[model samples]
Target: MRALHVITGLGVGGAEQQLRLLLRHVPAQCDVVTLTNPGPVAAGLTADGVRVIHLGMRGNRDLGALPRLTRLIRTGGYDVVHTHLYRACLYGRIAARLAGVRAVVATEHSIGDTLLEGRPLTPGVRALYLAGERLGRATVAVSPAVAERLRRWGVPGRRIRTIPNGIDAPLFAHDEVARKEARMFYGLPEDAYVVGGVGRLAPGKRFDVLVRALAELPGDVRLLLVGDGPEQETLRRTARALGVADRVVLTGERPYLPDPGDDAPGVVALLSAMDVLASPSAEEAFGLAVVEALAAGLPVLYASCPAVEDLPPDAAPGALRVTGGAGAYARELLRLRAAGPGGREAPQAVRRYDIAYSARKLMDVYTAALAGSTLEVSSP
Candidate 1:
């Protein structure tokens, strides 16, 4: 079936990268629509031969883009219109309904009890989201925690479906040679014990907690902050103030590499190079990077990651949920280092998130939506 996927922007965030990976495995013909800033991720989609339409939306108040998107959806003759992120969900659902699309679905990638996009979940925003949600046949949550949050927000239980984000497991498998190469490329000593964190450098992510935790760790232990955002300068200053400036390496923002084959030198390589991964964010919807690190056979110490917490310990043997506080994280780092330099192999449970498996599950959702059923699928 022909499908149209709409998102806010094509930046290198988790939701955008997840769309890129999902398209690779989905058998149906799919096209993409980006509201604005069709950045690097758009180029990757084009290279893969997918059609990406950019709607030049000036800002949120730009109502003109609504009619434009509606016309495109109607003209494209898509069987299903799937939306992602905040702005896309708001506009795409209305546009799909206006365009007379029978199957409308949206994936709620980021939503928490306290915040939505780093801001408080005000009542006004909740009202608007609930209104928009009614236009869709189903809303897919990336984790059961997210599904529970949706229910708390007053969405009916039948309207929500839990579909955990999938990764290309084998692509991130640990590699000794690649690990050495990644360390060399980043100018890190081969023996340096690295603690890495990947995601948007935002206040909500609490990357500063990692900087503080780094200060408490031994001098030889280094911190690798991947991705970038408004918190870059703040994190840099925090590292400098804490006297660990030399040890903290901020790689800025890197392109999202969905399929990192054995030799691809992007995120997968960075994950391979790290001894252990640390995610100190107290608020996380899914923790895609944590899962990717697990796929790369790196042990993860997370403070508040719903993705890993929802699973049993045996499901992700390498993941450990630590309490909030830099000292707590520092202690965990020392304990992990004492064991070994490299992380343990990924558990067999990680295979549940394979992109192929997710594609099949998504097809079921699409089929059910087309058939006019709001039945929720069992979580993986």
Candidate 2:
């Protein structure tokens, strides 16, 4: 089937990267459209031979792009239209319907009780989202918690489908040689006790709390902040104010290899270099990096992360859920470090989130949407 994926922007954020990965496995002719800011991921998609069109949307109020998008969808003769992120869902769904495409689906990647796109969810936002949701056939949630949140936001329970975000597991597996090389590449000492967090440096991520936690830990413990965003300067200042600037390694937004065969180590090497993974974000729909860390055989201490919370204890053997705040995170880190590395492999449960599995499931969603089957929420 011919499918067209629409998104807000082609930045290297979790949702954008997830789309790049998903397209690699989707068994259909796929193309992409970015409403604005065709950032790094746009180039990566182009490198992968996927056609990416930029609408050059002036701003949120730019309604002119609607007709342009609608024309593209109608002229492209796409069999299905899938939207990702908020703005895309809002405009893409409307444009898809205008283009007369019946199979329309949206993936909710970043919505939480505390925040939506790093901003508090106001009443106006909810109304706008509900308006867009109605135009789609199904809304895919990255986790069960997110699906429940969608219901609370007035999306019908019948319209929500829970599909956990998937990762390329084997690429992230632990390797001693890789660890050594990665540390050297990052200018980190071989014996350093590294605690890493990956994602855009946004306020909702509570990376400020992570910097505070670093202050509470021993001087030898270091912080690795991956990915870049608006909070980069603010976080740098916080690290300096906390007197841990030198101890923190901020590797500005880097390209991630979506496929396992890519020559570069990419995120896998960065994850391998660390001793532990810490996702202190207060608002997380699905902690994709945390799952990658689990696949990499590193213990993860997350605060209010539904991705790990929804899993049974045995599902992610080394994962620990903790309260939100610097003190709580610091305590958990110390406790887990004291227990030492378990040398455990990723649990079989993690394989359920493999990208191949997600591809098959998504194909089912597309097929069901075309066949007019009522979609029901399923547990991951």
Candidate 3:
């Protein structure tokens, strides 16, 4: 079956990565369209032999290009149009409907106001989006938290389908030699305990808070930050001011996985090198990175927000979740680091999140979406 996948941009993020993974494994023919033109994700699509069209939208609600989008969808004759992210989901679904596609679907990777950190969207905009969200043949929630949030916003539970995000398990499974080699490449001290944080360098992600936590640790503990974003400079300054600049390694936007074997084993290796994974995201949809760390057999000290706490129990063990505030985070760091069981063996807690298994579950979602069956959101 022919399908059209629409997204905001090709920049690195969970939503973009999810599309990349879906493109690699979806059991159907697919094409991608980027409303904000091409970026890193475009290369992934091209590598997959999937056609990617760039519409070059100048700003939000740029209807000047709607006719072009409609023509392309009609000409492609796709049976399905699946959208990711807020802007694309809003406009792309309407465009797909206008093109008269048989099915339209959207995956809400994070809650609606993730940009606003769980706050309600402006009343008018919320109403408008609530109506737009219901336009789809099916709305997929990447996690239960996201689905429940949608329900609170007036979207019927009947229209929401929860699908937890999946990772390539083998990609995150532990590797000792590779972990050492990765640390050596970064000139990290062999005996020093490492703490790593991965994800976009944005305010909501709270990378500065991670730096603060790193400063609270002893000198032997170093912090490694993967990925890049608009707040890179601000975070760099924070590290410098916190007097941990020398101990911080910022590998801006490193490869997700150097070898396809683990999708992005470099990340896994970094996780293996850490005594603990610190995910201080104030808001997260599914905590994919936390799950990856668990799969790598590393314990996590993450934010205790509903999104992170609501993750399946199978993925949460020996996990020190902090819910209070900055002081709470510092206390947790001190507690975990003092009794640090630095990289040892892969924990048995991660088996349920195996990539192959999750991929199979996702395939079922694709099959159901294609067959027009409504999917139910499961309880966390």
Best lDDT among the predictions, by candidate number: 1
Residue range 144-253, candidate 2, lDDT tens digits: 88999999888988888888898988878888887788788777898888999899998888888889999999988899888889999999899999899999998877
lDDT by candidate, in order shown: 0.88, 0.87, 0.74
Off by over 4 Å in 2: 258-265
Model 2 Cα shift for residue 142 (angstroms): 1.1
Q: TM-scores for all candidates? A: 0.96, 0.95, 0.89
Please give the distance, in angstroms, between residue 53's alpha carbon in candidate 3 and its true position after superposition: 2.3
* 2 against 3, candidate with superior TM-score: 2
The positional error of residue 83 in candidate 1, measured at the CA in angstroms, is: 0.4
Please give the lDDT score at residue 2 for candidate 1: 98
Q: Deviation in angstroms for 115 in model 1? A: 1.7
lDDT of 1 at 232: 94
lDDT of 3 at 106: 84
Model 1 local distance difference test score: 0.88
Per-residue lDDT for 218 in model 2? Answer: 94
Error of 1 at 268 (Å): 0.3
**Residue 136, candidate 1: C-alpha displacement in angstroms:** 0.5
Q: Rank the candidates by TM-score, best first.
A: 1, 2, 3
